[model samples]
Target: MRILAADIGGTNSRFAVFRVGPGPLEREGGLTLPSAGATDFISLLERVWAGLGAGPEDFDAAVLAVAGPVRGRTCHPPNISWGIDLERDWPGPTPCLLLNDFLAQAYACRTPAVAEARVIQPGTADPRGAMAVIGAGTGLGHCALLPLERGFTAVPSEGGHASFAFVGPEEGAYEEFLRKETGRPYAYGDLVVTGSGLSLLHRFHTGRDLTPIQVAAELRPDSPTLDWFARFYARACRNYALTVLATGGLYVSGGLAAKNPTVVDNDHFRAEFINSPAHAELLRNLPVLLNANENSGLYGAALFGQRALEHATGLEA
Candidate 1:
């Protein structure tokens, strides 16, 4: 089957064409485009279609992994100006599935596509247990996969929007500073653990506003901004693991984590991640992995598309 898959995050969107069936899933062509220039997903699709020289009619199925809370067939990504409705904006008559981007990544866990996913923390991986995936990008995105009889079931979450938990005096002080800076009572995890949040943290530490890109260029060995950023990310991961009881593993994906792996490579990162107090040991025993492959989302969308196509045709298992 010819399947088109798109992984739409808050910052960028990726498009790919895949051929899946009784053989290995294959990608025919793919492209990455910035989501900022366009006002809506249809416009973005036009650009992709023009670039690929193939329109929606060329594909038998399509799946979109959107960076937002997917309600039914629609999505309103936080940083992007546009929202997507599958029924209203889908390109063709073939079935289309809209899912939270991270949920799609969770689905990719079922494929050998993520076989190279890096294991940062070595621990027991319980095949039957639930697994968690979290990533920081235009915003923090999280999801979980519960092991089922035949495969795993992906569960989408807005855990990134949950209240940020300040664990230390420095974090508490930073929280106060954030409140004063944003005029908000509480810091949301997305605001303190993403690329934008990293930039904001850099501003808080250096009193100079710099985008994540600029900050990356000037980050020093003693950069408190990155230190705090790593801690917050670790804490967020820890919290999510606890929330979902992800004994199978915890996989971190997203532009932020994938780009700056050092954030989770140091001693402080592991210390923060395994610090669950009462259940610290339990947390310690769970594997912590990072989605090394950037295209996991697209691969996942293809997998989902294949399933959706089968279901719609009454051929699904």
Candidate 2:
């Protein structure tokens, strides 16, 4: 069976074809399209299909990992100009799955490979326990991985929008600063820990706004603001870890964290991660691993499509 999988973000869309046999599917070459390449999603799909030299009927299954909420059969694109209606113009009657982009990234965690994943927390991972997965990209995305008797199941979560808790006097001041700047109550995943969040923190500290790219160019370890934001970011991770009892591990994946290895790989992050009030001992021993694979979402989308097909056909892998 041939499976077509796509991971669409606000900035770029990546599509790949995979051939499924008895084992894991083999990935064909993928094509990356900029968000501005097409006026609409259908046009983008047409271009991708033509580039693959395959008609609509050539594939038996499809999966799209979208960066927005999937309501019924349509997705209101998050920050993107185009909206997606899967039922409107699909090529065939084949089964298609639409999932939150973070959920797809969580699904990708099932596959293991040697990559440059950073260990933000040095703790033990209980394979039979629950895990938390978070990514900071177009927006903050979060999901959980629950361990079952047979394998693992992925659970979508809205933890990104959870209320931001002030740790102490320092964080409280920062919260006030954020409130005054954005003119809104501070949320955990709002302008603090996201890609834009990091930039916002930088702006608050520097009295000027800078894009994520520009912030990266000016990042300095000795800068007090960057140091404080790093601690705050780690504190958020720690809070999530405590909430879920994520003894299985905490996996961090996203464009911001993946690109800025220096920020994520510092002692400050780990220190803040372990700085819990009552459960400090428990958090200190919890394992945290970063996803080094850039194509985790694409792989996970393909895996989701494959499993969805198996379930529909009543076949067990």
Model 1 misplacement above 4 A: 313-317
TM-score of each: 0.95, 0.90
By summed lDDT, the worst window of 10 consecutive residues in model 2 runs over 308-317
| Tens-digit per-residue lDDT, 101-203, candidate 1 | 9988888887766888777899998899999999888889899999889866888999888898887787787889888988877999888998888888888
Best by TM-score: 1
Q: Give per-model CA RMSD.
A: 2.0, 2.7
181-202 in candidate 2: lDDT tens per residue? 7887665674677777777778
Stretches of model 2 off by over 4 angstroms after superposition: 113-116, 168-170, 183-185, 313-317
Candidate 2 lDDT for residue 30: 76
CA lDDT of each prediction against the hidden true structure? 0.85, 0.77
Quote model 2's TM-score: 0.90
lDDT of 2 at 222: 88
